[model samples]
Target: MNIYIIIPAHNEEDCIALMLESLVNQTLLPKKVVVVNDHSTDNTQLIIDGFSSKNNWLESISIQSSKEHIPGSKVINAFYKGFETLDKNYDIICKFDADIILPKNYLESLVALFNTDSKVGIAGGLAYINKGNQWIYETIASKNHVRGPFKAYRKECFQDIGGLKASIGWDSMDVMLAQYYGWVVKTDKLLKVKHLKPTGKTYHKSSKYLQGEALYKMRSGLPLTILSALKSAISKRSFLYFKNTVLGYIKSKNKNIEPLVTVEQGKFIRKLRWEGVRKKIKI
Candidate 1:
């Protein structure tokens, strides 16, 4: 399978080199890798230049965007900058972060999963963050979830889902929409990708409510939103996170913000969410 990767990087000089190195060393190298330097004031561009100069498959592009570290729109916008330069000849398209170091076989293993199952729409490795001495699974999301940082989507499924949303919940939104369109989201626990930075570590204060806003935009409704908020708060062990999320939801509803999904899609999402909740309860 021909694989193409687009990495949206903003002020990621500290870790971008490592990420590039991992990709260049991958056993199954991507057909092309485009690193979008999103308004970085750091030496990110220098490092990208260093790699691109030596490697034919790798290249870099620059885009001007906000430096505020807003969760969704900023990165996805940068991704599009790079996406525009590529043709639609790729079998698998990946949106990777600038702070991750994948195993040499990460892309190869992902291809294996896709080859084994025609229904699989998305496939990725688990993320592990280094603690005191050992790397442990990142607990922010379910084990079943393939996090935003290392997403690889089948080309057909990517187009079917209408591509990614320029919102805080794009990752989750894509997965749900893929399932809605009859595609399976798969995660390989054995493919451990090293996450150099913990998720949300550098998010600006303005992003506090974006998660809640994302839930509202997804039309998750009040009850499901509450449950989702609670789960996040518990996982992060912060009451403020819960309060902010709920308040954000109410704020968006009151403001009558546009939703990410249509009425029928929202109904399907709500039913799917409820089914997951019920299954968890039964467990």
Candidate 2:
């Protein structure tokens, strides 16, 4: 498979080198790798340039964007900047973070997974963050979910879902939309990737309510949005998360923000989410 990767990075001088090194040393190397240097005041560009100079397949592009660490839109916008430079000749296109280290066989395993099943539209490994001294599974989401930090999408499936949404719930929306379009989302527990920086470490406080807004945009409806918020609060053990999430939903509802999915797609997503909830509780 002709795999291509786009890494959206901002002020990641501490970890970007390890990430690029891992990719260049992959068992099955990517055909091309583009790293977007999004308004970094640090040595991030220097590190990327050093690697790019040594490796012909690796390259970097700079874009001016807000320095504030907000999620979703900022990162996706940077992703498109890198995405625009690549040709549409890839079998698997990956949107990876600058702070993660992939196992040497990560790409090779992904290719094997895709080759084994044609219906698999999205495939990725689990993320493990270093805690104390041990690297443990990041519990922000279910093991079944492919983290936004490292996602690989088959070209057909990526196109079917109209690519990723430039919104707060873009990561979750991609998976739901893929399933709605009959594409299998697969996660491999064995291919553990090292997450150098824990998720949401640098997010601005103002971005807290974005999660609720995301549920609203996904047309999760009031009931599902509340349930989802409660689940998140419980998982993270933060009541503020629950409170902010509900408030965010209500605010978006009052403003009547445009939804990311169509009515038909929203219905499918609602049904899918409800089914998952029921299955989890053995209803």
Candidate 3:
């Protein structure tokens, strides 16, 4: 089956090249690589263009659509734009960041999993920051709404989900929608990759992540979603992750949460917000 990878990049010139190099070295290289340049002012687009001209396997698309100029909407628009342009014959499509470096066998493992399991709709690999020994499992789970850096989805499954939601929590929205539709999503712990530490300010600020979660949970029906979150807490490292989510829910009632505060930060508040009666989203 043919495999395609879509990278949504905005002002990521420094790291995008490294990621592209890894793709060239993949044991099971993707049939095509599409990098969506989201109106970057820097040389990010130039970098992609340089690679695409030299590497027949890589193709870059410059997207300056007005629909993608908004906050969360940009990512969803880029994702959908890539999905629309990607070759239809490809069986699998992967969504990844331009800052990540793939392990040599990353694509190999994903292709194997999809080929072996007919029921599997998406397979995500482990993502670590820098060369740090620690795994940001909780952060990745809450941020991307699933495993980050290495998410591969079946093309048909993606189409069935109506693509991605152009909302506050686009990444998590994608994974949750897959689960809601009975699609099997699996994480391969053995398959690992490095997300190079971002230099200067990062958009991945914790407050933004939590806000995404809060907005996502509210938009997608909080009661059932919180129950699922609780299940995630119970199943994975009950003491640390699960308890944290539960506590975050309980604490949201008292005050506005702080920045960089993960679900683990104000555990009770998150739980409270998830279970609140006026949890419906505004706009």
C-alpha lDDT values of all predictions = 0.94, 0.94, 0.65
Q: Write the per-residue lDDT of candidate 3 for residues 213-268, one digit (tens) a residue.
A: 44433342345446656555566545454444444444543344332223432343
Of 2 and 3, the candidate ahead on TM-score is 2
* C-alpha lDDT of candidate 1 relative to the true structure: 0.94
Q: How does each model score on TM-score?
A: 0.98, 0.99, 0.69
Q: What is the Cα-based TM-score of model 3?
A: 0.69
Q: Is candidate 1 or candidate 3 better by TM-score?
A: 1
Residues 1-283, candidate 2, lDDT per residue (tens digit)? 8999999999999999999999988999899999999999999999999999999999999999998888899999999999999999999999999999999999999999898899999999999999989999998888899999999999999999999998888999999999999999998889999998888888899898899899999999999998999998898899999999999999999999999999999999999999999999999
Question: Ranking by TM-score, best first?
Answer: 2, 1, 3
TM-score, prediction 1: 0.98
**Model 3 spans > 4 angstroms off:** 65-71, 131-139, 142-145, 197-201, 204-283
Per-residue alpha-carbon lDDT of candidate 1 for residues 122-157, written as tens digits (9 for 90 to 100): 999999999998999998888899999999999999
Q: Candidate 2, clashing residue pairs?
A: none
